[model samples]
Target: MNSLKRIMVGLDLSEMDDTLIRYTAFLCSISEIESVYFIHAEKSLDIPQEVLESMPTGMPADEKLRTSLIEKVEHYFGPDSRTQVEVLVVEGSPLKELLNLSKVNHIDLVVVGRKFHMRGSGLLAQKILRNGRVSVLFVPENEEPKLDHIVVSVDFSDYSLMALERMLTSALTKPNVRITCLHAYQVPSGYITLGMNYEDFDKRMQGFAHNKFAQVLERFPSLDGRATLHLVKQENEDDMGELLVVEAKRLKADLLVIGAKGLSAAALFVLGSVTEKMLRYNDDIPMIVYRKENEEIGFLDALLGND
Candidate 1:
């Protein structure tokens, strides 16, 4: 899983910025954060000719935007910050700028707001989660920044395993934080070929799931006391995401985590179907699309030129 050291928080200068800033500060206080960047992205920083004609001083638009955001960060990022903080206002698509900045800065994690009643796009969030090599955390407007209980979506895939193991580390999990490994399983429709009835097939699926869960526990014997597995049967054909979200809410999870699957070499991003569903259905519970960073390097990924 991608580490959480240098974090980049996306700010849009909206009400959500308040929550995002405080939440990031809360994270910085808890984790071993080396640096944090509060960035606001715009399509263009050029002031209109009519607007510029009335201005007395000729400060650049990006500089003005940066100054405004820095003031806000200072006022709300708390008084005892120990980590390095930088404010940036860039010109580009908000999503693309965030992706490019992540690569350019060697950023480990990207935190952004997950609006509920406010306007938001699951598709855009999906793209950011899939395109960026770094992990992405979605913070709801009203969700508290505390990391008390983390509910991890586990399907026994490598990605799922990576997410769970990373969540147990000191970066995100405190000594007293509770951990839940949530698994949702469903019986295949082809059970009739095996001469088994629906009820028996269901029981078989449950048993197989438990067996897999046991093997997983063997790998992480330390999880004996640290984590608990909550299993649910997926009833509908396309209900894995909704089921996970409902269970997470019922368990009063503060944070939800799932491993990310990026673009494959031969084709486009293998945006896991269930993950895409969860992003669309989830309205609360801060979620982390955690994945190990890609090894590929390019022009933007070569160096952190910003000092």
Candidate 2:
């Protein structure tokens, strides 16, 4: 229902690569995905001119490595998979190639793995989070995706609403999936400087959060008794991203959903601060970064009010 027909998965030939493939396969089983492209970008390394000249250009070392990697990936999937799979081995920067492939193929979702070390996949994941145009799912190592308890971050913005809509549509397809809408708010610094009681300020903020939650729920009548709303008060020194990670761990959430951008105007096609921070802090839970739809504006409309 969310229109995820084509998914591109970046493979780094690590142990986590299998986990990512299995997760994508699971998603394909549930959704109507038509194709899954498993791609590996072989980084070009410096070599002596004589050594390069000695090797034939017909089939380079990278091409051989790519062929081997494709064979390995195919062995993992075996021949029984119902989904159509394609394996590609390209030579370039992994992040740049992945972004370009997604755009060229009109991919709906891009799946990649995240590791604890910041060497290969971890660094690539960070770049994708910041620059990728399409939706991305960062699957953690050694974790089977259950998607049982999902925590979606909301700020009542259009991007956040897009996340909520995607989550609801996906959740409706899964059985016994628990959805929690989390909103983290902080009192204005001015209020604290004004000598307002912390307790009173917290109470007022809680009331406001409750009203906002109600209004959000009013927009989606179908989620009346299905999803639960959670409000968290942010401490002066606490980061909203860290708070979200803590809450997700407490909820034992298998998946976390967040908008790619925030309410800020500058966040048009970039990762919002909170989303970026969360990816940096947490490496265990998988996350889905949902992007808002593109609405085209004409040149005349941009210059004047109407044509």
Candidate 3:
């Protein structure tokens, strides 16, 4: 909603298993989107005599596949969304091209499908969090794409506060809309040199977390009666992503909003391991990743989730 004039979406040809793209188009159609960019990034292959010698079979060039994928997106979204559509087919990494196109096109939001769950803490998610320049939404595979109950995960950072405010302004249209402010906690994994009691440490930590939650509530006037707060004590049993997904599912939340750091050097080397894993989750729960900036953070909650 945030006066979004341009929107960009990254698509993979093989993962056309659902109506995510169409759903996105529909959402855009209802908004004030001036244009939409559908991008497909493909891998290239150069046939070498030595490599040909090793090949058991020959395959077609990757560009053809890329074009075909772009065509399919055009076919699906073109007739329905009716908004201006620009298609780009590029070689090399999807993430890189996606980011480049965002800059070149002056896009405000980049919508992508998350095929799997991200693993271990990585810098890629961090960088995306910090430098992506634009807001990014990672849509999950489950939970029918609708806007309804939305849970905003908060760490009480400046960026996260912006995210919460944006969600409140953009995504909720109906009077019955509900927003839950979730803060997660977990015990650290390490050795203590001091002889301090473990129970005392936990008690103090819990108290600090509660105080932080209260402070978050007091900081935002937009959240007054529109949002309720919930504190989640992450058992040593679950990772951050899992804990988030579980709570969203339990609430039958239509959308889950979380702030991401984007990607780091190490995360890039892994080639979509972190974000892709989060995408691969078979659930229909859709999510949007937002950059921590004043301009990018408003009305994002609606676009981040379905109502």
Candidate 4:
């Protein structure tokens, strides 16, 4: 999770590809990435007879697409870039192709477009987020190429710690980058059963949360300037995820990172509830959903069988 050697950028034939290309190049310039693959999946490489007859280029659909993507990479990624780039044009279901290619190529990260104020339905991003085992970076259409501030949602769980470890060991661990572990807690109604008043229990809850954060921070000296922000869930605050998105925006965070609790899509990959909730409410900020990729994905076989 720390050393991201290779990555795959999912490209759709849209304006969003321009943004993804630039952002991915910016990432390679900063990180120690060795290889990058720009992949686009088409339902079919066959063009209708009428369509082929009216086309500007006589090349096959797949070859033309590959040339266009390569040109885009050369334009934004630059010819002198250190990273080795490849263009893959696959024919099949987009989701199936992307998932299979990533596994076959041993990709460390999957970069996909998170359409906001764009033409896409954002369905591909969600499907990739839910089904892929590798880490995913969801870049919105208008997202800038930056990684200054990273906000990680924490509940003092191992899943949250896994995410924080990634940031600490990631290439963005430079002095300029800032990482904040945000935690949201609620004062239980049972606190009153312990013979403490509402105000007394509230202060106690805050104290407990601070102690936990201190312990967690003590384990990582690299996070010296790192701090925690605690939010008390109000009676009517139905979604904690909304609060996290709000605070991250308030801090002008460039990326949101979280660890999904389990490997199953039903368990919420790259989400751990934070991303699961914000997927509905968030529109602008990019998010990095970290999850453990199982060695073998039976679910993928099911998806492929659906074809």
- Most TM-score-accurate candidate: 4
lDDT of 4 by residue, 51-144 (tens): 4443448787877778878888899877688999999989998887888888899988899988867787878877776667778888888778
Candidate 1 residue-wise lDDT at 256: 95
Residue 242 shift from truth in candidate 1, angstroms = 1.5
Each model's Cα RMSD: 4.8, 6.3, 9.4, 2.9
lDDT of every predicted structure (CA atoms) = 0.78, 0.74, 0.60, 0.78
Q: For model 4, what is the alpha-carbon lDDT of residue 89?
A: 89
Model 4 has an lDDT value of: 0.78
Q: Model 1 over residues 137-239: C-alpha lDDT tens digits?
A: 8888776778889899999988898888777663778767888899898888899999999999998877887788888889877677778888888876657
- Model 3 scores what on Cα lDDT? 0.60
Return whichever of 2 and 3 wins on TM-score.
Answer: 2
Q: What would the per-residue lDDT of candidate 3 be over residues 1-307, giving only the tens digit for each residue?
A: 4546777877654353235477666566546567888776655454344533433344454445445555666766656565788776677655566666888988767776555443322223223333466777666543245775788878787656776766655533344767887777765644254555666666666787778877877876656677777767777766556676677677777777765443444333332442334434425676766654434433432332221
TM-scores, each model vs. reference: 0.85, 0.81, 0.64, 0.89
In terms of lDDT, the poorest run of 10 residues in model 3 is 298-307
Order of all candidates by TM-score, from best down to worst? 4, 1, 2, 3
lDDT of 3 at 110: 75
Q: Which candidate, 1 or 3, would have the higher lDDT against the true structure?
A: 1
Cα error of candidate 3 at position 240, Å:
3.2
Off by over 4 Å in 3: 1-4, 15-18, 44-82, 91-93, 116-133, 169-176, 186-218, 236-238, 261-283, 293-307
2 against 4, candidate with superior lDDT: 4
